[model samples]
Target: MPGNMVTSEFLVDVDHQRCRRCKRCILNCGFGVFDFQSMTTADSSKCVACHRCVVFCPEEAITIRRNPLAFREHSSWDVDKRKAVWKQAQSPGMILTGMGNDLPWLNVFDHLLIDACQVTNPSIDPLREPMELRTFLGRKPDRVEVVPSDGGYRVQNPPENNIELDIPLIFSGMSYGSVSLNVHKALAIAAEKLGTVMNTGEGGLHQELYPYRDHIIVQCASGRFGVHSDYLNAGVAVEIKIGQGAKPGIGGHLPGEKIGREVSGTRMIPVGTDALSPAPHHDIYSIEDLRQLIYALKEATGYKPISVKIATVHNVAAIASGIARAGADIIYLDGFRGGTGASPAVIRDHVGIPVEIAVAVVDAQLRSEGIRNWVSIIAAGGVRSSADVAKAIALGADAVGVGTAALIAMGCRLCQKCYTGNCSWGIATQKPELVGRLDPDWAAERLVNLVNSWSLELKEVLGALGVNAIESLRGNRERLRSLGLDAATTEIIDVKPAGR
Candidate 1:
C-alpha cells in the first residue's frame, strides 16, 4: 500500500542498527504500531502517533513525523487536521481514539483558589489538633421535635446511621472490567486503610473484593451487569450511573478480547462476544420511571440509601432537582473533564459542561426549590488536590470524588493509552504480566497518603476561611470570587471580588 494513500498510517523512519529487536516498542505501543512478523520488525500503516513506542524505545530507533504536505491546498486551517486527512483517504471514517475526554476546559481547580490561614489566625496542626474530615451522605430530618424530660430535652431516634468516611473524598466508579482486577484490589485495600469508599463502577462487583464490602459502593448502570439480590445488598451504598462525564449519551462497551474467564463469569456473559450496554435504560424513560428503579433497588436492599450519578451537562440544575424528587438520597455530578477507560476521540474531546458551573447551578436551583437539604451533592472530574475539594465544597458540593489524582498517586503517568488494554502502569489493563507490575501494598499506601495529605490541606483552607468544619463552607458563595469571570459565568456563579 502507498504510504500517502493510507490516511491512518504513521510517517515513520527507523534506524535498524539502533533497534536490537528488544520489541519494547511493539509491547508498549497500544495501537499495535510495531509488529514482529517472523524475526523482522515491521511498522503498520495505521499509527495514531501516540508517541508511546517512541518514548519507550531504549535505543531511540523510532521517529514518527506527520506529513505536512498531506493537507489539501484549499482545506481551511480551522478544520481538524486529522479529520481532514481521514476524509481525503475515503477509508472507514470513524475516528479511533483512546482514553478520556481532552478538551479546552474551564478547569475548576485553576479557577477556584483555596483559602489558607496566614500569620494572623493560627492554623491547627493536622497531626495534633482534631480536624474532622467525617462527612454524612444521607438525608437529614426536616425538623427535630424536642421533648422535655426531667433533666433536659431529648429528641427522638434520628434516621438510620449510614456509612461514615474519615474523609470527604471517595473513589469514583471505574469498574473491574474497564480497569483491572489488581486495580480493584488496590482500591478496595486503599479505601479500607483510608476509611473512605471505593466505587465498583457499573461493570459489576468482583466477589473476591466482598471482604471489603464496608468500603465498597456498588454501582448499577443501564446494563445492570452482575446485579442480583446479593450485589444489590453488598455495599454500604448503591449508585445508579445515568451518564458519565466522558461520554454522556453513549454507553460502555467492554471488548471481547479483554473479557477474560473471570470477567466473563462475573458479568455472566459469554467470553468472546462484545458486551454492549444500551444507550438508554430500556425500562426507564422519564423521571417517574427512574423513581421506580430507585424504589425497587431500595426495597431489594432493605431501604439502603441510593445515589444517582449524572454527567455535568447543560441544564444539570433542572435534572438534579428531578433526581432529588426521584427518591435518590445522594447525587453525584461528574464534570466533563472526568477520565474514562475507553472513549471515542471525538466524543471525549467534546461534550458536557464544567463541574464548577454545574455544581453552582445545581446547588442554587435546589436551594431555591427548598430541596437543597434533600440530597447530598458529590462532585467529580478533574479533582486534583485538597484545594480542589475545598473549592468544590465552597461551590456547593458536599463532597468530591478523586479518580485521576488517585491513579497518579498510584504511579500512573497519564500516557492516555488505556483503551489499548496494555497499560504499562497496570492500572487500566487486565493482562497478567502487566498487572503484576503493580504492588497492591504500595499502591494502596500511596492512595492513603494522597488522601491524608489532602485532608490536612483541607483543614488549613477551612481555618483560613474562618470556618472550623467543612459543612460551614458548603455553598458559602460569600467566601468565593470569580477572577476575570465572563458575564455568563459571573451570573451563574453569583460571586464577585471582595471590593467589587
Candidate 2:
C-alpha cells in the first residue's frame, strides 16, 4: 500500500513471473496509479481505467480489475447510482465530465429507416452513373433571374456567397487549447484535399495555418478569444458560435495551465491567464442584436458567408428561423450528444435535445415558414458513422459536422482525459511531450481516408435510395420510416412508422 488506501475501488493483479521490469506501464500512465518500485499498481482508487498501462506493458504483467465494491442492492438505486451518491457526499465539487453524455437515450437516426429501390424504381449504379454529392451551403435566393442572350438564355448568379463541397461533410471546430496543433493541421490538410471546410474553433487560427485559409471556417465564440480582422478574413467563412451541443447555456473555463507559448500567441491572451467565455453574448440581447453582429462580421470579412452555430434545444426551430431572417447564410445545429473537451456533468447530460430530432424539427420549421432555402443546415453532435451522416442528410440537413469521429480516426481512444491534458495519443494535449505522439502527415492522410470512406458509403446509400445526387436525399423525409417510436415522436420527426 502507498499510504492512501482508504478509497480503493480497483483490485490490482500482477503476474510477478511475467513482469519484465521495463517500467513501460509506469511511464505510460498519466495517473499515478501504478508503483515503480513494486512493479505493480500502487493506488487503485486513482485509476480511471484509461487502459494505457495494460496496452503498453510489454510483457502483459499487469491486470487491473474492478473491486466491485459490494453494497446492499436496491431496485430504485443501483450500484452506480449509489456510488454516485457516495462520491457526491464525499466532496461537494462540480462533476467535471469529458466527451458526450453516455445515457442510452433515443437516437432518432437508429429509429428511422431508409428506403431503397427494389422493384418499382431502379437503383442508381454508383460506379457507373454520375453520383453527385456536391453540396452548396449558404443562403439561396427565392428565385434566380434569367435573360435571353445571343447564345442562349443566361441565368444570373444568385445573391449568395455559398461554399460548394465535394461531399456534404465539414470537420467541426475543436479549439487549439482543447486539441493539439497537429490535429488542426491534419483537419486543414484533409479539408483541402477533400474540397470541404475545417473550422478554426474559438481558440483562433495559428500563423502556420494561413496557407489553408481558403478551406477554413473561422469561429467567433462568446469568449472571442482570438478575434481579429485578419483572423476573420483569413477564413472563407465565419461562424458565430452561440452555444455547443455539449454544454448549452453554460460558459467555458479553460484552465490557465494549458495556455502555452503557441496557444497564447494563437489566442492572443497572456500565457498564464485563464480563458473565460461567458454564457451569453453581451451584445446579443435579441435576434436583432444577433443580426447586427452577423452583418458586422460580414462587413469586416468582405461579405463572406456568416454562420450561426447553436445547440439543438427545445426551441431550435424558431431560433433557426430568426437566424435565417438575421442574414445568416448557414445555421449549424449541434445535438445533445456531441463531444466536448470538458463540461459540467449536469449540463452535458441533461441540457439539450438530440441532434436528429433537432435537425428534423429545424428543417421542417424553416420549410414551413417558407424560408427553407434561406440558410443551409449543418447537423452535428455525436455523428459517429457514415450511416449517421446519411441519416442526417435524409432528415433534412444539407451537411453534417464531424468532430469526435474525426478525432477517433486520428487514434483517439476516447478516454475522455482531454481536459486533464494527458492525451497520450497527441490529439488533445498542449504539452509538448504528449503532443509529439501524433504525426501530422500520417494523421492528415488518415483523415482523408476516413472522409473518402464516408463519401463512398454516402454514394452507396444514395444509390440504394434511387437518388443520383445528394440534393435528392436532402430533406426527403418521405423516404424515411421510423421504428419503435411513439406517435408524438413520429409526428414531430414527420416520418411514418414502418409498413404504414
Top candidate on lDDT is: 2
Task: Provide the clashing-pair count of each candidate structure.
Answer: 2, 0
- Superposed by TM-score, candidate 1 places the C-alpha of residue 480 at a distance from the truth, in angstroms, of 1.4
Tell me the tens digit of each residue's lDDT in model 1 across 1-500: 55464344447666787788888877776555577765325464656565657777889998877645455555445336555465657665555455456555566457655555677877655455566668888776766778887899888745453568788899999888778888888899999998889999987888899899999999998888888889878899899899888878888788887788888877777886677888788888899999999999998999888999999889899999999999899999998888888776667778898888899899999999998878999999878778778878888998898888888887676657677787766788878777776798888888888888888888877766656778888898777776666667777877664355
- How large an RMSD does model 2 have? 2.4
For model 1, what is the C-alpha lDDT against the true structure? 0.80
RMSD (CA, Å), candidate 1 to true, equals 3.9
Q: Where does model 1 exceed 4 Å of error?
A: 4-80, 87-90, 116-128, 145-157
Candidate 1: Cα lDDT at 396: 93
Q: For candidate 2, lDDT tens digit of each residue in 1-500?
A: 33432355566666779988887777776666778665554577766666777878788888878787776778888666666666676677777878887777887888888889999989988999989999999989898888888979887865568898899999998999989999999999999999999998899999999999989999999899889999999988999999999999888888888899999999999997999999998899799999999999988988999999999999999999999999999999999998898898889999999999999999999999999998999999979888899889889999999999999889887767688888767777898977887898899899999999999998999999999999998988888999998899999989989998
Count: clashes, candidate 2: 0
Q: Which stretches of candidate 2 lie over 4 Å from their true place?
A: 1-14, 38-42, 60-67, 146-154
Q: Each model's RMSD to truth, in Å?
A: 3.9, 2.4
